[model samples]
Target: MTTSIVIRDEQSADAAQIAAVTLAAFATLEISGHTEHYIVDALRAAGVLTVSLVAEIDGRIVGHIAFSPVRMSDGSAGWYGLGPVSVAPDLQRQGIGTALISEGLARLRAIGASGCCLVGHPAYYGRFGFSNPPELALAGVPPEVFFALSFTGQTPRGEVVFHDAFKATGPTPA
Candidate 1:
């Protein structure tokens, strides 16, 4: 596990490994409100997925992150929303997830995305600059657990509907 793990764009061939990692990570969550596995499949099938990146150690996949298109309520702007980033449970806290997030955000920014939004623990994501901008709102998302960070441009306040896949796979939080 000491060898440097490489972060690279995911290929169609990596689908199974990706799913396995996702299942492992989501299982650790306190809630199963979201079907992490189905969401990834739907995102891939829907073609909204913008970035699919993976981490590997000695050629075995260990972590992953997916970014997809999202919009504000006003539709005034569009940005990539980060989600469902996962690392094999055994790999947690090894900085594998951190590398995936860092590299994925940089890639999204390089592609001209204005920002990234997500639902996650404020404490963990805050360390990476994920926060809810008072000026931005994704309706139906708890203002507390909901988080966002900008790469550039204004992130407007509005209802945030994560792709339909999110709903189909994970029950929406009331």
Candidate 2:
């Protein structure tokens, strides 16, 4: 069975639902090593959650993704960080997550992001033009898996440091 989903930017009031979706998305995944619900809450609290997109169907949110600010060492340079992309377990592979990611990336570029980076599955993020940052790989990162895409001059060279909240989990809720 298949279902249709619509993607849209998240509203302020959707915080509760957004957090809930993230919580549910990571409830069963130990890949993150622990629950990620706390990360989502922290992101919301930090006020850096500039971009959020959701995939909804029949009034229910089935997928969610967020974009926050990331900076290079010394915090002098910046790039958008993509993560916590979640899809309802049952709705995985229906393109809901993809839509949310696409919308968020578009929004970031529109808002003047120089580039975007994320710690995610190379196979997945690679499909969207996110490739390892070889120019200035983050310390301890394989570089091949730490992908980046520049919207301006060069893939903003520097280590990819996502929000502190992002490291608290495996991109489940944060």
Candidate 3:
């Protein structure tokens, strides 16, 4: 049976839950450094979490997604990077992640964002209209995993740099 999920912008009260969910989601992923929660916290603290959202079911936050401004080497603006999307391990493949991504993308477009990009599994992101563009790249990331979705009909051509918060490996600074 599928439970109904409510997608909404995250509030301050949801910080700890978001962190817990994030940690649980990436806990066993071999490719993860297990620092997703820290990255989320750093983004929030740095004021660069352009779009932060959560998926709730029966008043419990089971999933979270974050988007932040990305710098394009070709001087392109209005583009954002998507990442660290997390869904509870037990809740994986239940559409919670999809809901968070869909709502987050809509929110970004509504705010005039030109596009969004991410380093993710090719098969997973392709269903959401994300594609790997030859001209747009994320250094050190396999081209197959770097995907972009252009909302404004113009895909940026250059290197994509996600926010520095993605490098956070410890507690948020005071």
The lDDT for every candidate, in the order shown, is: 0.82, 0.75, 0.94
lDDT of 3 at 5: 92
Per-residue lDDT tens digits for candidate 3, residues 1-174, read 367899988999999999999999999999999999999999999999999999999999999999999999999999999988999999999888998999999999999999999998878999999998999999999999999999988999989999889999999978
TM-score of 3: 0.98
Residues 49-81 of candidate 2 have per-residue lDDT tens digits of 888788889889877888888887645454877
Clash pairs detected, candidate 1: 34-170, 138-160, 139-159
Pairs clashing in candidate 3?
none
Model 1 RMSD, rounded to 1 decimal: 3.7
- Per TM-score, the best of the predicted structures is 3
RMSD of each candidate relative to the true structure: 3.7, 3.4, 0.8
lDDT of 3 at 34: 92
Which residue pairs overlap in candidate 2's backbone?
A: none
In candidate 2 the C-alpha lDDT for residue 85 amounts to 84
Alpha carbon lDDT at 171, candidate 2: 44
